[model samples]
Target: MKKNFILLFLSASIIFFGCREKIVTVEAEKNTNKGGLLFKIDKVNAPKNVVMVEAILSRTDFDTVKASLNLVTETSADLALNNIPIGAWQLNVNAYDSLQAIVYAGETVVNVQDGIITQVNLTLIPTSSGLGSIYIYVNWGKIPTTAWNDFELNPILPSPISSTPPLRCNQPKVLYDDGKFKMWFATFKYGFAPNTGYAESYDGFAWNVVKENLFDLQKNDSSSYSRWDANCVIPGAVIKENGIYKMYYVGFINSSGEWHIGLAESKDGISWERYPEPVLKANSTEYQISAGDIIKINGVYFLYYSFRYNTISTMPVQFTGGISLATSTDGKTWKRSETNPILTKSQGWEVSRIYYPSVIVENDRYDMMYMDGSGTGFGMASSKDGYTWTKTTTRPIFTLADTKGAKAYEVVYPFCRKINNKYFLYYSSASNSDMLTITIRVAVK
Candidate 1:
């Protein structure tokens, strides 16, 4: 049976309301023409005694509207307005107390698409916050508003190494340490990640690419006949673990062209050594997989990897992409989390195919920057425990149009690093949409 649950949260206030059957529909994932919405209000912002809450979902023509049951939730629950028709929507949410008094109310925009799971976290602005009539603090799956100043600069540095026709630089990992900025990128032909390059700068802006390939696949054990990543090798999340630098990379097989996660190690970010075997490999259900980001929490390593499910037709869109998690006590031996796919595509520019997640830890939250694989755009998300992420906005914070004067074809592979309290995003442009031919650029905020 189709069902929807409603939840209300606020600080020092509690409200409970109900939804009309004609106004909402809870759906199953079997529907291709519809999408899912995960609607939630921050409990800390909710009052102490909300007995009821009302959730209203209104949509446009393209997003189909059908009727479903609305169940009143008694406590904290996983919020969902599932199988919603894909289109722009308006969600009006309100909270009520035991006396049925409306203490907090707010409205926000929601966009839905089949396969894309949109998350909207609401914070209630009470009357005490000055001339406010209860506004919803919702980022709607985009970057935080306080993020960048829309500052972008082109031609920051050269490709990891020089490349010839049909081969271009792709996938970058940047780091800031000891008052210097260092970068590692890959050089690959179409559909193959074969080599890595290095660059450095005293300042995060100007960079000089050393004319060297950090590691050649032909020289590493990856070149072995039985190695899964013999065909491709892309640089991924690099982090310092136990005073030793670890690199998690994407590797592809020459025969099946399948994707796998590989490992490398370095004392410094420069010279590196590789693990003889793939650390993570795709199962029968995954079409392709690549590393997104990695962070350690309480001695456990959290590895975020982007993947596409085997069923393309069942997706909201053909290229629907999601990010999942795997944990390892020893970065080499790993196990997939039961919660796999901790993140999925959100609506707007990220409705399908979001990949290459770059993340950094700030305070207690994990901040993320991912590429919109369906289009040339980049967006942000955050997580508390490195599993469930909150997409900051509904739209991409920046896109191909944001990179001025590049006049490039497809600008992608967004790698962000925080230096001096500012985020520096480094990305490249592909002459062809398939990540061939490269021009690296940067945006600071």
Candidate 2:
């Protein structure tokens, strides 16, 4: 009886050990299936006093946490966190000063796939109020650092393989939505025969030209006012209304020598059809419409454009006009504001001409970045109502000092877009080396 009892105990022990080994193997396999994250963080204005970093990761639902990491750092750090579960996660990173207070903070959402390492790049801005809203009148927040690249994209359709005069590209309209970053710009060779073109990118930095001349010059007719846009078509502001893309552009016949605003619609962001007549024309022969910015608020379209009373042969094109405002209910018929020119020449930097108004309405205020006719640089203004604008300062908000002249001849045509909670100001300029060739550049805040 004692021998049988010992044998039974040994058999039970062997089966239990076998089961334990199988469980260990399965657990190891599960660990190997996990994914990781490698984050490359760029500190926009990291203080010299920053001494450490605190990085935290949580599930997208905020119900569970993956990791809480702390590290000693200098001005900036490249952080790595591994073994994150395969799913969506939010990363909140903070840069701390010597006092252990958060000097800068940034957060971004990332997707981790099984057995894959996801790479993320982020620009961290300071949490201190010093980094955000500093203004006596118009609050522009902070000045941005410029991102200059040598990449160039030529006109897609009207570009001749070999032409007497080279083609030029300008006026970029950037949009990030539906999982893609898209741009629509104008390109023309010689003469004012401009057309709208398309380019796209997975990331905003590198661009791929998709289609050139998506919308070409409209058909010309006999009537002078009706034929105003026959020669060249340059798109100003593009927005989606009722599931369709609408573009407001300045159309002009170089021969007629006057410009007016026209409207076009597209089912897709690409391919467009123009309305038969100009939506907003120069009712007052005193001023002719030029390129402007448009935004929709409460189903009303606000159009802000520059205008010139008469063309001067010796005057530079950029300095011809000031900024004006008009409103449209259907984006077809429009009413010029009672106070027509909302913003005009107010300071020496403006050179008695202010145009290229880029307006962003935020927090019950209208924030505008505009270029003066001198092409010296841009200025900032704010308004409660779109009509009564208050210039932030007499100084130019963006300009190139004497030493920076080698970088760009002049900066004009400001456009602002916000991505990942960061503000990017896009504009066209000519480098001193290639003053005639216009190129696009960006400044990030």
* Candidate whose lDDT is highest: 1
Residue range 1-445, candidate 2, lDDT tens digits: 0000100000000000001110111112333555655433223223355555455666633344432223343332344444455666665656566787765555556566674435443323222243211000101122334432221221111223224565456777777766556777777665546877776644344345667667655445456334667776787888876788888888876634567888888888788888777888775543568656888788888899888776555556332568888897878888888887888897887876888888888888889989888678888899986778999878886775521212567777778877654566667777545566665555555
* Model 1 agreement with the true structure over 95-201: per-residue lDDT tens digits: 66677676656666766654544544343433333221233323233344454442222454453234555335657788776555677777655543477777765
* Model 1 misplacement above 4 A: 1-153, 159-167, 189-193, 219-223, 312-319, 431-436
lDDT for position 317 in model 1: 38
TM-score for all predictions?
0.61, 0.62
Clashes of 2: 1
lDDT of 2: 0.59
TM-score of 2: 0.62
